[model samples]
Target chain A: MILQGADALIECLKQEGVEVVFGYPGGAVLTLYDALYNSQFPHVLTKHEQGAVHAADGYARVTGKVGVCIATSGPGATNLITGIATAYMDSVPLVAITGQVGVSLIGKDSFQEADICGITTPISKHNYLVKRAQDLPRVIKEAFYIARTGRPGPVVIDIAKDVFAATMDYEYPTEVSLRGYKPLFAGDEEVLRVCLEELRQAKKPLLFVGGGATISNMAPEIRKFVNATGIPVISSLMGLGVVPGDSSEHLGMVGMHGTYAANMATVECDLLLGVGVRFDDRVTGSVEHFAANAKILHFDIDPAEINKNVCATIKVVGDLAWSLPLFNKLVKDFAPDIKEQTASWREQTAIWKQDKPMTYKSREGVIMPQQVIAKLNELAEDAIVVTDVGQHQMWTAQFFNFRQARAFVTSGGLGTMGYGLPAAIGAQIGLPDKKVIVFCGDGGIMMNCQELATAADNGFPVKVIVMNNQVLGMVSQWQRLFYGERYSHTSLKGRTDYVKLAEAMGVTGFKAEHPGELEDILKKALATSGPVLVEVALPSDEDVMPMVPPGGCLDKMILGEC
Target chain B: MKYTLAVLVENRPGVLTHISGLISRRAFNIESIAAGHSEEVDTTRITIDVEVDDELELEQVVHQLSKLVDVIKIVNLTRVDHIERELALIKVKASKVNRSDLVDIVEIFRAKIVDVNRETMVVELTGEASKIDALCEVLVDFGIIEIVRTGKIALSRGPIAAKEM
Candidate 1:
């Protein structure tokens, strides 16, 4: 069909099975917004461009689809920068469409002009500047394909204003054929055989899963492998939901603030089978001491990450979705009695789990952040939980019990604040039938609190639980331990009523200042038909426990309050 | 130790900035770099020379460069027997009396005098990096006015294509 670039973009989106877009319109994108008005595709107008991009990111994480977002040029494009980087770091599939000035005005510094393609080069999987209306269809096709392909990441397609108005005969490309871009899916048979032999012979073998496993949709395969071998599983923060929380063989999250048993198991294991995980600094406290006694078996789709941080004794570079099942098959065929081989190791790990459990002191009259997360977990077991970075994020990772794949979504690599509320909006929009909750800290909530209006306006029914500690909890903890406890600028001293703020944004609001009132307030907030916010006041000085200090080994963790 | 890496990347604008930005952001110094279109249809090959403390730093540089989306492949030329060359243009101060001597020096190095004037003479030399440095050292005595040198470009001495690997 012959159509203008803006109409063609909408056509391409429909062809790619995109049902909704999160965006904010501006002068540069006025024509596209006009096209959207007459089209059936729903575009949710977000309060901020950053919130739109983050909502897209959240949608992609939950639905496993390439989430789409649109914005104007210059500031609008720049506002999406943080969210784009967040998506890039976490390997989420997102396609950001930005409106640019006309081609003649691009480099001339015209009004509202910026070099977005250049700015996003390092952060995006790939980017394009559309100079012709004819190229829009092909670019859109390639953008979606690249965003959703191997090692999924964000891609940017900046369309010029004139191109949006120009006419073109559009035909969406059926397939993408880039000569230099091919992702490997199958693992080498020889490498799998070697890994199987190591698993069969090792006295103590542990399965370490990461976000890569979850991204590749290999949770079922991982669970099958773990069950067949009876190997204990430890997860990175992003890998939390790959193994059900109820599984006896699964250890809690392992990292800087990981559980005691998880960290100990990492140190004592003889063989570490890492799947779909880059050894981030948080996970491997000190590289020299991380898995020192283990022969590492690393499996990932990105070859650049194989030996980037930690070296693998036997590296298998392939998609986890394919390589994991192959490993399962090889184990079933070769090492049928793998459970007996690692029986003693499991017994030792059980002792570690029992000796040092995750514990926090219960103050008589004060509410605890851990208790709030625990209560939410109990009441909303099936809700998709999202969190912003900080003390509450770590607390959620520690206290909440995630039961299904893609049930927990948070900014892992970038650790960006203001991520929870918008991401919760995205999750709620993606899975409307499922409950969606955002566990945010006071510091993070204040960063993008404007998103509350976006949720209430759309009636998405997202529940926000704000752990309102009066200080920057994580940074305060670091200062108390490392610095002279000067507490420079970490204490947030102000009186901003969170419940009143929520009500002002047209959302129902509740507050709980005492431990006894939290449960009732939380239940009331969750039962609301529309968006709601529950602000629970927490102690100002509580620190996340089992923290591995900077440059310290996992074994040198601080177990309690310093 | 100094290492040379040949990085093949998609031919696109701002790709060079992406590569250089990554190196600079990591605080790694690039001694010299040269880039041009490769034999591939839409690929450009860039040769970068870096001086690092050890092999570990070199490995990290290679790994980080490979992380860029435009970067298709990268190979360290130090691991194989390779041929490297650099081109340089030196403009030297010249007088009537010293003109013959300057010509003699150029002849000895098999260098060509690309331009000449009453006050200055420009000599162009193309050879291995060491040869270019040697020529520069000899011409310095004649009060060299200015010099421009292309960074080192190298290829392995074999039939195998690095991109195919």
Candidate 2:
């Protein structure tokens, strides 16, 4: 059928099985908006472009699908920059579509014209500027394909305004033949054989999983491998949901604020199997000291990442989907009694966990941030918990026991604030039956507080819990610890009531001021249903403990209040 | 060690930007880079010169560049039997008295005078970078005014193309 470019884009979106697009209408995208209206496709008009993109990111994380968002040219496209970068850092699959100025006006600085393709080139896996109607189908197809392939990331597609009015014989392409874009899915068997041999011989073997494993849906494989090898598993912050929280073998997240067991195990282990991990500076406190004794085995889809940060003795450079299952299969087939080899090592790590468990002493009449998250964790079982970046983000990662894959979604790579509310709304939208809860700091929630209106309007039942500490908790903690207790400009003491703010935004509001009130109020908030906000008051001085000073080794952590 | 990489890529509008942008983004310094259409249809080959600290870092540069969606293939010409050349056009401050001497120096280097004017003459030399540098060193006596150089271009000495390699 012959159709305009915008209509053809709609057809392509349908063919890609896109359920919805989160975006706002603007001048440059008017023709596309008209096409959307004609098609009556499912669309979300977010409060802001940032909100829409983040919502798309959240939806993608929850649904394990390519999240699509749209915006017009210039500022609308620019606003999506932070969200795109956030998704890129986290390796989330997303496709952002933006309408551009007409073809002739492209370089002339016409109204709403911006070099979005160039702006997003670094952040996106790939980007394109489509000037012809005929290119719509292929571009859309390729964008989605690239976004969700090996080592998934965001892709941008900018459409010229004039092309939307141009007509074409629209047929969605069934296959993409990009010569440079094939995703590698296999690793060298010889390398795997050597890695397995090392694992079999090592007395102290540690399995460190990261976001890559989760992205590849390697949770089951990780579980089977850990069970077979008896290698105690540690995780990066992004690897939270990849291992079930209740497992005895799974040590908690390892990083600057990692648990004592995970950190010590990392230091003491002789064979470190870093599966689908980047060995980020945050994870490896000091690169030279990180796994100093261990021969690192790296597994990832991107070959560039193998030696980018950490050197690997055994490089299984392929998709975790292929390599991990193979690892599990080999261990099951050949090393069925591999757990016997690491039994004593596992016991030693368990003693480390016992030495310094992640714990805090409660103060009289005070609502600690940890208490709020713990209460939420207790009450809101089977809910997707999302968090904005801050003390609350770390607290969520540290305290909340995430059992579901892709359940604990946050801006790990970019540490993006203002991510929670919209992402929670997006998750709720994607999985309507699943409960969605968002944890935000007072500073973070205010960054995108306008989204409360978006939530209330859409009536997405995402429980928003703002851990309202009167100051920027993490910043003040850093200043107090590292600097000479000079708080600087971290205080957010301005008079703004979150409960009133929630009510004003047309959502039900609740507040829990004291420790005794937290669990009951949390229960009520969870039951209130339609986009409720529960502001839990917290003291400002409480710091995320067990922090490794910047560039300090994992062993040199500032444990507890000291 | 410095390496010359012949990167074959799809002749797309922003493919060059993708390659060069990525190199810059990764903080990898490119000594010199030149791009042109290759023998293959709709394919462009880029000759890039880069120096790295070790073999691992060199591998990283190659693997990172290869990650770009428009890059079809990358061949390390320095690793294989390759013919490398750099073309430089040097416009020397020429005088009637020194013109014969400058011509003598040019002849010794087997360089050609591509352009000439009353006061200046442009000498074109195609050779290895060291050879071009040597010629410039000799012509320095005539007071070299300005010079333009095509960074470097290379081809492996084999029947197989870079894409095949």
Candidate 3:
């Protein structure tokens, strides 16, 4: 059957089970917007291209689906660069469709033309520049496949504007047969058995989980393994919520601002079982000293990750879906009771956890950021918490009690600022029944503040909490500690009012200047029907404690005030 | 240490960009790269030589390259019995008087003078990059003009293609 190119693209999206897309339309994508007018799937019109891409990324993280977004060529497509790089770093499954100039004018620097495919090449898993209308279905199919497969990432499909109006015999491909793009599901069982043997022989073992475990949804498997073996678990920042933080055996985050027990145990353990984690620099400070005494057993779906940063003594190079279940079976069949053998080690770690738990002092009538998060943890035990990068982000990671998988979403690998507002909106859209709360600092919130308009326009029930410290909290702390207290440009005091800003964007706004007012404002905000912003005043001199001091040993942390 | 990797990739537009882009993005030090269509109908063979400090780094480069969707296979030719060669075209400044001497030097190195003018001559050599370097080293006294080389390409000594392996 004959179809318009735009209709064919819409049909392709439907076949891929895409329920919605976020985008800002322009001249290049005029035909696509017209066709989308009649499609069953909804299209969200964001205030900016960056907001749209971030929304798509947040949607993907929570729903475990390939989030789709669209933009026009030139500046419109360029605006999506930061969001694309963010998705790439975090390995989010996304498909960004950018409308391009007509094929005849492609390289002539035509109006609204840009080489988006080339620009996104390094960041994207794969990208395509479709010059002909006939190639849409196949490329779209392959794009979605690549984005959602093993070690999922973003893929870009830049289509020519003329192709959208061109007629074609449209049909979506049922199967993708790329010779090079096969997702690994199973791996050598023999090596997995070797890993199990290593686990059995160790006196002290630690399970280090990362984003991969969460991305693969290995919560049940991890839970069973830890439960059966009584192994203490530590998590990377991105791995938060894969296992409930309340689990007695699970330590808090283990990195620069790692929990005392997790960092110390990493150095003293006889064996370290790394599940679905890359030894990122932020997690492995001073790689020479990281796990120096441990025989590492690395399990991941991507072979490239093994020995990429820290060498492993044994590796099970396969998806956790494959290796975790197999390892659990081996544990059930042949594992010995290790709880008695490592009782002393576990006791030491528990002592470390209890003795130096994350804490901050409260001043008279002043609200501390950690208290705000702790209150939320108690009030909204199951809320999906999102955050931008800063002191507020670390406070969220440290204080929040995540009981569910996909419950905490943030820009982990990229450490992107201005990610909270739009991402919270997308999370709310993906899970309408669940409460979505976002935290950002005064410095980061204004970077993409325009997204508040989108949230209000759609009537999305996302709670945005601004930790209104008068200065850039994290950088100022670094300056105070390391850079001779030259605050420089960090001060954000006496700036525009967040409440008025939120109200101007057509959303309800609230502010809590004192500690007593926080609980009331939080309750009112979360109970409200649509999007609401609450700015909680915080002392500017606060710091994320136990910072490992960049490039220093993880165990040699600078314990400030805490 | 320098390692040679023979990679088989899908014969599609932007596959080379994907391969080279990855190498540069990861900050892998690439010694040289050469690519062309292979025996297969829809495959391109790319040979990359990379310098790394350890075996682990080499493994990382290979694993990362294999992750590219267009890259079907990668074989570390440094580990196997392989035939390696490179083609180079060298230009040398010569007068009519010492042109015969230049010819004699080219003959000894198994190079041929592919082009000649009144002032300079172009020498064509197809052998290991080391062999071409030797020829150039010998001809330095003759005032060599310029040289261009297609970095090393290699293949195993059996019937199996790299992709099949």
For candidate 1 chain A, which ten residues in a row score worst on lDDT?
A176-185
TM-score of chain A of each: 0.99, 0.99, 0.99
- For candidate 2, give the docking quality class from DockQ: high
TM-score of each: 0.96, 0.99, 0.99
**Model 2, span A337-423: residue lDDT tens:** 568767899899888887788888789999988888887788876899999998999989888998878998899999999998889
Candidate 3 lDDT at B48 equals 91
Q: What is the C-alpha lDDT of each candidate?
A: 0.90, 0.90, 0.91
Ranking 1 against 3 by TM-score, winner: 3
Q: Which residue pairs in candidate 1 have backbone atoms (N, alpha carbon, C) closer than 3 angstroms, thus clashing?
A: none
- Model 1: per-residue lDDT, tens digit, B1-165? 999899999897778888887888777888899999889879999999999988767877987787676788999888988989888999999999899999999999999999999999999998988898898898888899999998989889889877865
Candidate 1 vs candidate 3: the DockQ winner is 3
Enumerate the candidates' DockQ scores in order: 0.45, 0.83, 0.86
Write one digit per residue (lDDT tens) for candidate 1, span A279-349.
99999999999999999999999877887789889999888877888889999864547798788889988
Model 3 pairs whose backbones collide? none
Chain B TM-scores across candidates? 0.95, 0.97, 0.97
Candidate 3 residues lying further than 4 Å off, grouped into runs, are A334-336
